[model samples]
Target: MSKKDYYDILGVSRDASDDDIKKAYRKRAHQHHPDKAGGEEAKFKEVNEAYQVLSHKEKRKQYDAYGHAFEGAGGGAPGGGASSGFQWDFSGGGFNGGEGFSDIFGDFFGFGGRGARRKTNQGEDIQASLTIELEDSAFGREKEISLKRVIACDRCNGSGAEPKSETISCTHCSGTGEVRKQFRTPFGTMAQNTTCTECHGRGKVPKHKCATCGGNGIKHATDTFTVKIPSGIETGEAFGVAGKGNAAPFGGTVGNLYVSVSIAKHPVFTRQGDDLHMKVSVGISQAVFGDKVEVQTLHGAINLKIPAGIQSGTIIRVEGKGMPRRAGYGKGDLLAVVNIHTPTKLTRRQKELLEELKKENL
Candidate 1:
């Protein structure tokens, strides 16, 4: 099907109030909400799309610049699902009677809450994948990440109206914000009750529009937050950043952020579960005669004693040289696999001595 004019579908005007758009959404969502038996999910989504666009400042600017038919340029319509392959489920508001609008609108837009939200509901948490070094992950770290999203426009404060301005009665609905249209069709005079286009079913209009945010309270911005990662965190582990997710519309609480960790690969040492692994090379004489050697670890080099007559492929354990275990448990041990090196060439006397020693051993 062809795309419907966003303003026409929502019964709003080129310049409508946020309250107007909200009332429009509630009206259509009530009728087209999936719980209504004959309701259409697509129509309900169209309503959400209209709100997501008209309610956000950057999106509204793009819509205003391109007139609701804005192409996403190269990327598509941000996260509104207007890009393509969008799904619409309507079980919110009084449509489901007990269902919430948040679920239905969330299918397209990322924000949470519908109409008005009560206290509680810790807000939705968002997960982000961040790559850090083992040193950083081990000792705890602070990092700044850039998040591109729609937040409340600093200029309008989510009201979408100019500050110090007032709202007056709507002209189209005669203060009802709704109107019943009567048209003389081929059959007879057909009448339909729909939201008013002039005031968007709000029954009011702002006397002045905000110049900074253009009367739309939300702005498209790059939000940067320095996330603090706790020590002793393992790879692929997750952390939380409170109140960092999408901001709730209509003065609701902000959402949270979740970050997934990825530690970098070490050059000389390998990690397995909390233990470190490394290869140690020793001369043939030292392997056979037992010697004390210095081993490398994350902290520093430590001395380890090798047993007499030790052979190649032998593993030596150095306790407490690995990563700290979670839950305050004991740390892991480092395993040093020994490799015995042989002399490639020897003098006549050395060769004679080696041959005599080999014969004696035999």
Candidate 2:
């Protein structure tokens, strides 16, 4: 039988870029991986074989020019001779001196060619939330938050050893923090170095464990700390505090704490970006004639002049009376919407006055 074309196998065009070929290979490999559900082992090997030739510039150039005849010219096919037929070899130096293939496998499979170690020293990050009033955002304030997190053990000083105890190298991995193992997959046998289970990748064990923390180097505790909320901070904005998260075991690097702020809804004022909006009620007479009215703002109540013959729903801009500008130096304006108050019930004298005004056309 004739061999299939490499481009057709990868489902890519003949002029596909190097990046496009790599992406296609990853997609095909993931789809046909033997460990996945409904995976086809033979198709998986075919995809790997196709990627092996196309990913290399020189091999790809030869394959494009000579087609299957390139293999007869000893273009580094599976075996030394072209008649030996094609085979998948993932053993020593099979993938471009192993670096490129190692990176590709490490990204998707979480394991590389050899000497791949899992990173466990860094502590996990913590997420928290803080609720504040809208007024609090107008003016910055410091708030105290409480949360339970992992902290370094006080008794061991985060060393996982007693005050005078001695430290010794791990016997399982001989201080290398990793152990070599061989895995048999559909492609071939793969050698992978995994983290040593006995030492947990630390490569050391305390001769005498700490009494309080039992050599864990960490403890669970409820911590309280103050966080500063900046002025004009919007809802859902997050601020980070360094070194306030969980502490790594055996005194490794500490993670960060991210706090998301949420602003409570105000009963009177509505915030639009940096601008504050509120409705100010005016009497019918006040709307007909000019009048000064007290308007509520985030800062305080201020006197706002109502223009003569002002119509209902008219917006009056009050400069420098809104929320403080979070990015710049100046404050935003407060928009006051005018609402005319119409009396539902009228007394006899009020009705008579309206009758006289109607007759005069006022």
Candidate 3:
């Protein structure tokens, strides 16, 4: 019986280039692979046989010159006399022509022996920013935040298919998540392994796709979560909450949610590490003599004593009154910087008293 034409089997033109021939053969191989649903073993074998003859440079030349006559006569091994219709040899009995089909397809598709491993379906992580009052950071607080992100479909539960739908092995890649394809480029016919587009590399096809997610198994949704703000957490720092990010599409692990924190600027105090610094103004009389004053802290107002003969730019400390320390023990002290307020406008009695004092001192 006459063998099928190699070019016709691959659905390519008679003058197809070596790369084009390989590409055509690759698509046919996946389409007819017996491992896939509705696969045709005979057609898959025919495709491989056609590629075997047309893929090699010397074999293609012979096939082009002598047509099926070269293969019909069994040709000569790999290398022999030109007139013998065999221009090349299998080198070292490599192509014994029995059980070499697997190796040949393996080499053509980069399957090594069987094939590459199936891909994982882990979800992607998401990031968001949270702003809080400085007091919230000074003393630990819990905050509830809402965010819009991609979440698993509640109807299908991230499966991508509707309930009661039957899943079958993929027909496009024969249940392989990856498909081996050949393409014609400027360089030459190059073979590549790509994720199967039909099933999105899931190796299975759903009879009915989920209507809500459109077979993506996810949807945009708003979710609420409560986050703990640890004391002493500075701005630009981030914390992670497990399984709070975008949900995986096909039953994979859920990703994490990263929350970046920012503290709003405070009007009364400036924070450095765990310490709070503030400026306090006193009258000249209060500075000259001892006085007691109230200062603001993160918690509440506290009394601070001013010693006699205090000068401007003097820093007074109120122990255990500042922000709480994150680790170890004691709270930071509140630093009060004193500035003596000189009278801008003096009354006549004050002017007279100052003049008399100055004269006595002189």
Candidate 4:
């Protein structure tokens, strides 16, 4: 039987870019991986075989020129010598040394097939929450927070050894930071390089353990620091403090601290994206006659003009009286919604004046 087209196998066009071919391979391989539920082993092998040919530049060129005839000329897939009557020289360690193969399997299996390196001793990041009042958000404030975290050992200076101790190469990895590992997958036996468990990728071990931290290179401690909360910061926004998190073992990089901020509800004002809304009650006479009234704002109380015969729920804008702008040099306007007040009881004189006014059809 004739072999299938590599482009058709990966569901990609013949003119597909290298990135397009890689993406298609990942999608098709994941869909047919034998270990996955409802997966087809035969389809998985076909996808791998197709990728093995098209992924290489020289092999792809040869296949494009001669199609299936290239196999007879020893241009078949890697490691397919003699039995398939074709072979491609991979002295540079084609599948084992190339980044493309390792990266693809890393995405699928969570372990790079080969030549994968990782920072095993890096510290872990920390997450925290901070709550501030609405007024504080309008004016920006500095806040102090406390946390219990891991710090580098003071006695040994994070070296994980006693003050005068000697160091030795890691026997497990023979002074190499990584160790060779073999994982059996549906594809075949895959050789991978993983961090040394004994030395945590440092490639060295302490002859004498640190007394302060018991060879861990770190100690538990409480930390307190001030964080500057910017003005106009919205709720659920986060800020980061570099190097304020846990200290790495064996003197690796320190982690960062992330603080998520939340603003408290204000009693009088409600905020909406740089604008403040508040209710301002005006007397019946003031609404009918149009007068200047004092309205409370974030900065201070300001005089607001009430138009004559104004209806309730009318919004009066006080420019530059709201919260400070976090991004630029300006302040949002304060919107005061007017509410007309009607007296439930009236004095005799007031009642007589209202009665007379009622007769005037007002």
Error of 3 at 283 (Å): 1.7
- Check candidate 1 and list the clashing pairs: 57-218, 126-258
lDDT of 4 by residue, 246-313 (tens): 99888778888888989988899999878899999988899899999987788987789999999999
lDDT of 1 by residue, 48-132 (tens): 6676667767556656666523332232333544442232322222222322332322222322222111222233456688888
Runs off by more than 4 Å, candidate 2 = 1-119, 181-184, 195-201, 345-352
Residue 78 error, candidate 1, Å: 35
- TM per candidate comes to 0.52, 0.67, 0.59, 0.66
Candidate of highest TM-score: 2
Higher-TM-score candidate among 1 and 2?
2
Q: Name the runs in model 3 displaced over 4 angstroms.
A: 1-119, 180-202, 327-330, 345-356, 360-362
lDDT of each: 0.65, 0.77, 0.72, 0.76
Span of 10 residues, lowest total lDDT, candidate 1: 112-121
- Model 2, span 171-231: residue lDDT tens: 8999987776554443565554556765668899888999999987889999998877888
TM-score of 3: 0.59
1 or 3, which is superior by lDDT? 3
lDDT score, candidate 2: 0.77
The C-alpha RMSD in Å for every predicted model, in order, reads 15.7, 11.1, 17.8, 10.9
Which lDDT tens digits does candidate 3 get at residues 1-362? 12678888999998898889988988998899766898886676567667876887766675677675543243222243222221222122222334333333333222122122223366677999999988788767889999987788988888888887888888899998768754432212334455677776789977788887877688889998788887778889888888888787765677889989998988988888788899999987888887998876777887779899998999998888878887777788789999989888999998898888789982
